[model samples]
Target chain A: MPQLVTVKVNRPDRRPVRVWVPVLPVALVLFPVVVLVVLAAIVACVVFRIGVVRALGAAWRVISALPGARFDIEQGRTAVLVAIR
Target chain B: MTEQRKDILDMLVAGKITAEEAEQLIAALERDQAPATGSLDARPKGKVKYLRVVVDATDNGEPSRVNVRVPLQLLRAGVRLAALVPPQALVKANASLSDSGVPIDLTQLKPEQLEALVEHLDEVTVEVDSPDATVRVFCE
Candidate 1:
């Protein structure tokens, strides 16, 4: 799982900007809220006859897969890059 | 021949098993081992961790480039998520896709099948070149 994300942006005649985002602290802060929401969702799924376990598994899979993703776009003198690690 | 096949042939020669039985044994061996041996060439040497797309184009004398690398696990996750969609929603989606000329059935997309597709994706590479642009897509 990635603990950090980096973003860089450059534009014509403008200062290049770069930022680093730490994901662990944010994830920790949201952990309890996520747990609560998940529990509620499970209950709702049970009531609605949905596949709770499968939905939870899928959500976890999506979260675990977010790392190692990168996007870069450059046009003329402008460029933007976002990377997760 | 594999040791198993040789053993089966030996059994046939020693009259321990009938010729038909030996043939059946060999067929079974092949059937059971197809994914393990026969498909080895098709399988990627290393686990594919990412899918990458790159495009370089010149438009009106302005050069532009795009590069994207997506985790392959995200694709697997998305496929798994598809399994959770309601049948009614899938039916509607299928109809919309058909109307859009996709001709695909979301209902028939099994996770296992998608897993196999993902495994084989590493073997696929697509490249396109034109006067103004070059595009490449591959797994790594």
Candidate 2:
């Protein structure tokens, strides 16, 4: 009974699961957003050209109506000459 | 009247006339409406100065950028279609801009938008002083 021996056993450590993780959904969603931005820019350019041309057409009509303001318009271009007051 | 005399009168009105020339101008006005006849043929088409305006696509490739250099008188007319910021309106619109120099930073105005604002802007006209030709820009 006095000859009994006690032995301590070392246990191997276990790794914990990583709970906080980065997801790529935000980046996945950004691709269409960028595409939409490009499309919007294209649309804006078309609208601007139409507006400018329309504005020029309207201006040409008005200038032609003036008595002394010499003007000409063709192929969407205009020229005007008026003596300074 | 001689072109020289007319120019001199213009200089007088422009406040470039010297004190010594005051007596000469007064005497000339009183002496005769006609100027010395010989100087009439000396004028060269009244100095047809040309102003150039170069327009480029804006960084965003939207309205565009228009750069112009003209006789200050023609600047307003040539860019007549380009909107001018009246000092008061400019001040109001560009309230975020610094009070010194020109009111540029605050407006964020595009060249085409400015052109649209002009009351009666003739299309982009490039007058060639070299050969008296004009190149017009059109929207396609």
Best by DockQ: 1
Q: Score the docking of each candidate (DockQ).
A: 0.60, 0.01
Cα TM-score per model: 0.72, 0.20
- Tell me the tens digit of each residue's lDDT in model 1 across A1-85: 7789999999999999999989989878999997899999898778756788878888889878989999999999999999998
**What interface RMSD does candidate 1 have?**
1.6
Tens digits of per-residue lDDT, candidate 2, B1-140, equal 66757777788878898856966976776567444453575544333233344444323333333333333233334344344323455556566555555557534665565545442233334433323223333211
**Candidate 2, CAPRI quality class derived from DockQ:** incorrect
TM-score of A-chain in each prediction?
A: 0.73, 0.25
Worst 10 residues of 1 chain B by lDDT: B35-44
**Model 1, position B31: C-alpha lDDT score:** 94
